[model samples]
Target: MKARVTISLKNGVLDPQGKAIAHALHGLGFDNVGEVRQGKVIELDLGDIAAADAPAEVEKMCTQLLANTVIENYEFELLD
Candidate 1:
């Protein structure tokens, strides 16, 4: 099975990197862009894992190491 995890900052959190990217876009004549938020995607190859158990396992990985869980939120999906 394959899994994908997305990690992102929660609402009301300041994102400096996202801000910088927005500023650069505006400088390049893309002023139409609004406030930008940044996130990350992680792809995992969980070989031989059952479909029913993949979500829980991946979520555990997120809570333990993949996400800060303070200012960030994480979600995942499994693929066959």
Candidate 2:
């Protein structure tokens, strides 16, 4: 099975990198952009552990390694 994890900054958190990207886009004449938030997508392949409590394991992975829970939130999906 394949798991895709998305980690993003929570609301009210300041994202300087996202802001910089948005500003650069505006300077390139893409003025229609409203706002931008940066995040990460991590894909994992589980060999034998795919069938059992995968979501919880993935959440643990996010909490322990993939994300900084202080200012970030994560969601994951499993695919066959």
Q: Best-fitting candidate, measured by lDDT?
A: 1
Candidate 2 collision pairs: none
| Model 1 per-residue lDDT tens digits across residues 1-80 | 99999999999999999999999999999989999999999999999988888888999999999999999999988878
Clashing pairs in 1: none
The residue ranges of model 2 lying beyond 4 angstroms of the native Cα positions read none
Q: Where's the lowest-lDDT run of ten residues in candidate 1?
A: 49-58
TM-score to native of every candidate shown:
0.94, 0.90
What are the root-mean-square deviations of the candidates from the true structure over C-alphas? 0.8, 1.1
lDDT of 2 by residue, 7-73 (tens): 9999999999999999999999999997899999999997678467888888889999999999999
Candidate 2: TM-score?
Answer: 0.90
